[model samples]
Target: MSYFGGQPTNPFGAPTPKPPILKRQVPPLPENLDMATLADIRCSVNIFSPATGEIIEVVVGVEKRKFHVHDQILRSGSAFFKTALSKEWKEGKTRVVLLPDDAASLVDRYVQWLYTGKVGVTLDNGKTDYATLAGLYCLGEKLMHDAFQDRIVDALVSGTREPNNNAGHPTTCSFPMKDVVDDIYKGTPKGSPARRFMVDMHVMQGTSGWIDVERPESVNHEFAVDLAFAMMQERAVTGETKTKHAELNRGIPCSYHKHGKDGVCGGKA
Candidate 1:
């Protein structure tokens, strides 16, 4: 009997041939490769050589606090720098980038992220500095640094996950207050990751008393409208009762990420 019913007649004519399986061949390693040399090559390709690269002065804020940064590092990390430092621009000729509108502290944080790949957002009181992180996100957006914005999102998410110690009261992670929300809304456009994050945080963790007392008049009209729509959507999916903060916390991190594509979180792989 053939594999298919009533099809046994063709079996004697010719056996069907199977397709060949192709294997991918990787190049062989060098016979006498030096590990130290290989390591050095990798480092040279990955790390910016501040010593060899030309230094550029970034004049930040109204006071024009000068921050000396490596041009190579700036161009490599930020699209704004890449364009501004190109041959056509005056900034390229002078090697001095002025950012008069941005805060000096935020620009300093950007410089720090360029070198260290880390963002510092913790305050002395053990609370996360949402205000600074929000500002950094805006700065990253202005600078066209997608990776930096993603990093700031990661910091925001991580900050909210940690137990915040407020005085001697019970530990609870509070979302960013009114001023931070206003700043983010003003700086970013609609459908921004930070805005979505704020909406999600409030919808998941917020109580009526918290809104009425803790953040009275903090939520602006735009934010309130977005929150209302998001809440309706959430209710449609999960039913009328508020979704637990634990369930919301258990959601995927990528949902809060700001990368261009869906399901793809940028910055770290």
Candidate 2:
């Protein structure tokens, strides 16, 4: 009996092999993991203009308006502040920054954008105050925040179109000021979104000529060249073969298109 009942007599005993056991692989944790420990930290900041000659003055513009702002909010919104307020910088130590180039009005708007994510845009008579937009855009560019730049562009584009009239007629588009156009071109680098936006705005309005004549004295030669180049490129890609045409067969009428009986479209075929 070879260790079993009725088993064959073993000429030679052989050992049975067992299946190999597998172990799960566990990843090692990093020695120094970054955490969001500072999310709840709050701080205050002072903004000053260089003219005031004091970091704590928080002066802005020629009028010398001052602003006491929250540091965490400003730092979160601006790449400029994030770097400027870093531990190694004097800005961080003093919690103060001098914005010599910024106007008081514009600085106020920037602070508002940080806190509320809104910029005051006034649109009137198919014309937008590009001056404000340009100033804000420049600040965003200087701070290296693309999102801020985009917000300004969005506001500009949205504000350019007029509200529908009572008769439902589509209104004329806004005309950008020469000062606004010039400021953007002067401050932004070549191929900047704001630069291209101004070019497109002019082109779409069929007023590329405005670029040449509007505030000629303030225009930089390089800016003019760039504008011309942008216009040419835009035209080349957009294609200018089609002429403006009107539709006569559509069933819908609207005041915006000067179609419907009451100056409103019924959305019919």
Candidate 3:
């Protein structure tokens, strides 16, 4: 048979239609191409200039683990470091800063975030590592980095609201456990954004089973009081026990953010 399965012809003796054109596969560029020659290539912020500044040795945790970070980047990103690295401080003279109380792993994460605006944490069973994030928040608080703390809050909110890989893709928004709560409450002071966010989470999505009444230690005293007061205020205003979990979980992104008088919400101008 012909290529068209037979000699195909038009009834009016018109020209037969041409076959569809096949697209040619273009080969990828070679691995050793000169990247500098590419036009309009945006460059990242020059956070690392080894030749320009001195290196600060940060000794963290009881183990005395050391991280040699660029002084300029560290000072530029952290208020604590900026103050500590100043000429008036002993750390500045010694060129070494010590954080004996903070967790080394968390310090490592902070360092990673300092270098690249992102850091990764190990998840448990495909679930977000709330405890690790909580630790990072506490570390950020200690470091006096509002931007870092705000980022942690954002991570917490996004992680909780993410859909699980279950049959229904249900949202497994588990409130921070007792240890996490204790760590946060102990690390952060009253009215801290982390504390407020925890209180709000419990008020919206908490259940009786979330707290073990028999084990009083499982609940932080301040957290329990805050939860009760929040629940009462909600009931008084709305006149119902219905929880606004959905709204709290997915509402305004800046609801739990910490902003100054003129500072913008969600860290944007």
Candidate 4:
């Protein structure tokens, strides 16, 4: 259901926009990643952003996240909801509330973010926390639930976010693709347009790309594979089946985004 009144519930799923995953040529590797042993990086969760009143089903990998543990991470992808909404994680000696809902089957993507600080998704999952929060800040961004979306945005923006990287591009297109992917996998609606103010910090690292992509995914696994390829591709040394390279730029082509994507990729603020 559209929680944003007339906005597309799942924009990425439709039309399946052409991804910016290019190498000055069409790639012939993405389709065969199935042989790469799709490692499971998902986690079942019930997340309540007290900030936005959003109750979410989080998919996380095996990472030690102190965000708001509603469930225990015994293994990977094996978890239970926190019973109720009051199971806010505390310091010590706090009671972890239990839930009575059947919120299972949400995993992998979230775990990707926990381990690598990034996530990605298709129509079959929930949006990662970071990307979902970014969408909320832009407002009008498509979302599974308005209140919940707002809460996630509120949490990250509410705090002091330390500099993660120098070339951290936060726009929908150049957006931490992996993070947005995580959110999409978890079923978070892509965002509408973003405001200049919001785009400045997140999109452009406090600079621009406010409106263009509602929910941005690389259109294919090429984005991620290409990225990983970039680092290792050149280092494969004699093509010994190890290391590759990636080709990522700020050209995913997303408009209709609110603030007009006023920044450059890699957060050029």
Evaluated with lDDT, which candidate comes out highest?
1
Per-residue lDDT tens digits of candidate 4, residues 1-269?
00111111122233212234324442221121222223332312212111122323332224422223222221111222222223454411243322222121222223223222222322232222445444433321221233323333444443224333333543322234444533333342223222222323342341224323455453334333433444454443443322221121234333333446574445333
Tell me the spans in candidate 1 whose CA falls farther than 4 Å from its real position: 1-52, 167-171, 210-218, 236-269
Candidate lDDT (C-alpha), each: 0.67, 0.55, 0.66, 0.30
After superposition, the stretches of candidate 2 with alpha carbons farther than 4 Å from their true spots are: 1-58, 62-64, 123-127, 163-170, 208-219, 234-269
Model 1 is weakest, by summed lDDT over 10 consecutive residues, at 1-10
Candidates ranked, most accurate by TM-score first: 3, 1, 2, 4
Arrange candidates by lDDT, highest first: which order? 1, 3, 2, 4
- Kindly list the per-residue Cα lDDT of model 1 for residues 1-269, writing each as its tens digit: 00000100111233223223334422222222234533433422222223225778888889998887766667765778889999899999999999999998888767655543444477767678889888988997898776677778877787777776674545777678777888889889899988999999889887775454465466577888998898888874444333544445566555446674455556447
Task: Give the least accurate 10-residue stretch of model 3, judged by summed lDDT.
Answer: 1-10
Q: Where's the lowest-lDDT run of ten residues in candidate 4?
A: 1-10
lDDT of 3: 0.66
lDDT of 2 by residue, 17-60 (tens): 22233344222211221122112112112111101112232456
Give one digit per residue, the lDDT tens place, for model 3 in 1-269: 00000111222334334333334422222222223422212213332112126778889889998887767656654678889999999999999999999888888767656544555543746666789888998897887777777778877787667666653547555456777788899999989989988888878877888888998876789999998898888765342422544345556455456775456775554
Best-matching candidate per TM-score: 3
RMSD list, candidates in order: 21.8, 24.3, 22.8, 23.7
Instruction: Tell me how far the alpha carbon of residue 43 in candidate 4 is from the true structure, in angstroms, after superposition.
Output: 24
Deviation in Å, model 4, residue 16 alpha carbon: 39
Q: lDDT score of model 2?
A: 0.55
- TM-scores across all candidates? 0.66, 0.58, 0.67, 0.21
